[model samples]
Target: MNSQARLLDKLCANIAPGKLEWIGLRSERRGEVVVIDQAEAVVGLGLVGDHRMKKTPGSARQVTLISSEYIEAICRHTGHSSIDPRLLRRNLMISGMNMNLLRYQRLQIGDVILETNALCHPCSRMDEALGKGGTAAMFGYGGLCAKVIQGGAFSVGDAVIRLPVIDSQERLFP
Candidate 1:
């Protein structure tokens, strides 16, 4: 099997959906992942917005960050606004995976193991944050909300790993 298929199959074995959409990045300044809810998340702060909180909701969206490619693609198509990574507020930005196919997949980027908790629904705050009506464009395309089962330092350039692959009979597939 190809590397991509190997990875996808591995992910499917661990969680219900075995796929990954993107990965995120943040400096050490921002506190590690604290809470991961379907709608929103929380990151512990030594001092709120003192210096490390990249933005208001630094850790709110973990695991999923907007990739440079996605930003470039959207901007190329819209030709109206350029997406600033700062405004994205995601930990890892990515491209390639069909976001719609991420259900029940076990995604492990770096040392952080995550399971897709739930779909990230849109809200008014998104509109205010991304500019008027921008939320509508992003309605179906925001990163996922994942619960981190393991705690570890995740830096940029880390490779994402999926669970080992298993066939229909629940046996490891060659």
Candidate 2:
């Protein structure tokens, strides 16, 4: 293998494992976010009561996750003091891991298992939530979108474990 491929593999393997730091669900699209201590993740759907629980045909964005560090980075870049996890509109806020490395891999949070689908690109709504340059500040730091593969209960403080990646020709970025 080439040096770049080896470096990528090494980086992926060394990502610091993270934990579920917070959970938030919006009952309706663009609704106020409700913080929850625990939630039931349903396979093929998403966290119970979340606005995005209903899967759209041909869509892989069943659940959204953001890194707490990423939030801090956005705040620093945007000159904001701090940005609440809920304001980011992602279902779960995680800490420690580089979520971008989990693409094409399975993640275990408590009893639930989720398959990483793709990067959850920042949307225009960011501008509404974070003001002015929110969308651009979150570029490349939006986090991951995943699909629940195993249904179970998960809660704040649960460890986020990245499972072995499935072998496929479909690279995370190509």
Worst-scoring 10-residue span by lDDT in model 2: 165-174
lDDT of each: 0.46, 0.83
**Model 1 worst lDDT run, 10 consecutive residues:** 33-42
Write model 1 residue lDDT over 11-59, tens digit each, in one string: 5544332222333334454333322211112233211222333443324
Name the candidate that leads on lDDT: 2
Tell me the deviation in Å of residue 107 in model 2: 0.8
Residues 1-174 of candidate 2: C-alpha lDDT, one tens digit per residue: 446545666677766668999999988988899999999988888889987876442357888889988998999988999998888899999898876677766789999998887888999999998999999999999998988889999999999987654445344443
Q: What is the TM-score of each predicted model, taking all chains together?
A: 0.53, 0.86
Candidate 2 stretches with Cα past 4 Å from truth are 1-10, 55-58, 166-174
Clashes in predicted model 2 = 0
